[model samples]
Target: MDLLTPDLGLFIWNLLAFLILFFILKKTAWKPILKSLNEREKGISDSLATAEKVKAEMAQLKSENEALLAKAREERAALLKEARDTKDKIINEAKDQAKLEAGKIITDARAAIEQQKMAAITEVKNQVGNLVIEVSEKILRRELSNKSEQEKYIKDLANEVKLN
Candidate 1:
C-alpha cells in the first residue's frame, strides 16, 4: 500500500524538476535538431526530383535514338533499292549489247559463207569448162591426124549443116 501511493510533496517536486529539465533542453537542442531534420528532408526531396528529371531525359534520348535509327534504316533501304535498280539496268544493257553483237557476228559469218560459196561455184565452173576443152582437143587431135582426113570431115560437117 505504501509503494502504490505517492506523497503530495514528492509529486510536486517531480513535476517541478521535469518542467525545468524540459525547458533547458528546449532552449539548447530542439531548434538545431528540427533544422537538421528539415534540411535532410529538403535534400532528399531535391535528389529525388533530380533523379526523376534524369529518367525523363533518358527516355527522351531513347526515343530520339530510335527515331534516328528508323531514319537510317529507311535511307539504307532506299540505297539498296537504288543499287538493285542500277544493277538490273546494267545487266539488261549488257544483255542487249551481247545480243546485238551476236547478231552482227552471225550476219558477218553468213555474208562470208555466201561469198565463199559463190567463189567455189565459179572456180568449179571454170575447172569443168577447162577440162571439157582439153578433152575435145585430145579427141580432135586423135581423130584428125591427116590433113586430107580433116578436110574430108570438114566437108561432111558442111554437108550436114546444109541438110539441117
Candidate 2:
C-alpha cells in the first residue's frame, strides 16, 4: 500500500523538478534541435530533387541516343545502297566494254580473213596465168617446128574463135 501511494509533498516536489528541467531544456536545446531537424529535412528534399532532375536528364539523353542510332542506321543503309548501285554500274560498264572489245576483235578477225582470202585468190590467178603462159609456149614451140603443123594450128584457132 505504501509503494502504490506517494507522499503529497514528494509528488509536489517531483512535479516542480520536472517542470524546471523541461523549461531549462526548452530554453537551452529546443531551438537548435528543431533547426537541425529542419536543415536535415531540407537537405533530404534537395537530394531527392537533384536525383529526379538527373533521372529526367538521363531519359532525355537516352532518347537522343536512340535518335542518333536511328540516323546512323539510315546513313549506313544509304551508304550500302549507294555502294551496291555503284557496283552494279561498274559491272555493267565493264560488260559493255568487254562487248565492245569482243566486237572489235571479231571485226579485226573478219578483216584479216578477208585480206587473206583476197591474197589467196590473187596468188591463184597469178599461178594460173603463169601456167597458161608455159602451156602456150610449149604448144607453140611444138606446133611451129613444122610449117604444115603451124598452118593447121592457126586454122584450128581461127575456127574455134569463130564458133565462140
Candidate 3:
C-alpha cells in the first residue's frame, strides 16, 4: 500500500516543476495563442456579417428583376394589342376600298349597257329610214318610165299638195 501511494518529497518537486512550467508558458506562448484565437473569432464574425449582407442584396436584386420582368410583360401585351388593332384597321380600310371599286365597276357597266342600247336603237331607225328611201326611189323610177304615168303622178302630187 505504501508503494502504491505518492511520497511528500516527490509531490513537492512536481508542484515546483509545474509552477515553473506554467510561468514560462504564460510569458512565452499564452498571449499570442489567445490573441490568435480572438482574431480568428473576429474574422469568422465578420465573414458571417458579410454573408448576411450579400444575401440581403441578392434578395433585393431578385425582387427588382421580377418587377422589371412584369413591366416587360405588360409592355409586350400592349404592343401585341396595338398590332392587332392596326391590322384590323387596315383590313377594314381595304374592305371599304374594295366596296368602292365594286360600286364604280357596276356604275361603269350600267353606263356601257345604256350606251349600247341607244346605239342599237339608232342603228335600227337608220336601217328603216334607208329602206323607206330605197322603196320610194324604186317606185318613182318605175312610174316615171312611162310619160302617161309621170303626168298622172304629177297631177296627183299637185292636187295632194293643194289639199294639205
Most accurate candidate by TM-score = 2
lDDT of 3 by residue, 1-164 (tens): 98999999999999999999999999999999999999999999999999999999999999999999999999999999999999999999999999999999999999999999999899988876776676566557664678888777766654543211
Model 2 regions lying over 4 Å from their true place: 1-14, 144-164
Relative to the true structure, candidate 2 reaches a TM of 0.77
**RMSD, each candidate, Å?**
8.4, 7.2, 8.8
Q: Which stretches of candidate 3 lie over 4 Å from their true place?
A: 1-15, 144-164
Supply every candidate's count of residue pairs whose N, Cα or C atoms clash at under 3 angstroms: 0, 0, 0
Per-residue accuracy of model 1 over 21-84 as CA lDDT, tens digit each: 9899899988999999999999999999999999999999999999999999999999999999
Assess candidate 1 and give its lDDT. Answer: 0.87
Candidate order by TM-score, decreasing, is 2, 3, 1
Predict model 2's lDDT versus the native. 0.88
Higher-TM-score candidate of 1 and 2 = 2
Q: List the residue pairs that clash in candidate 3.
A: none
Residue pairs clashing in model 2 are none
| TM accuracy, model 3 | 0.74
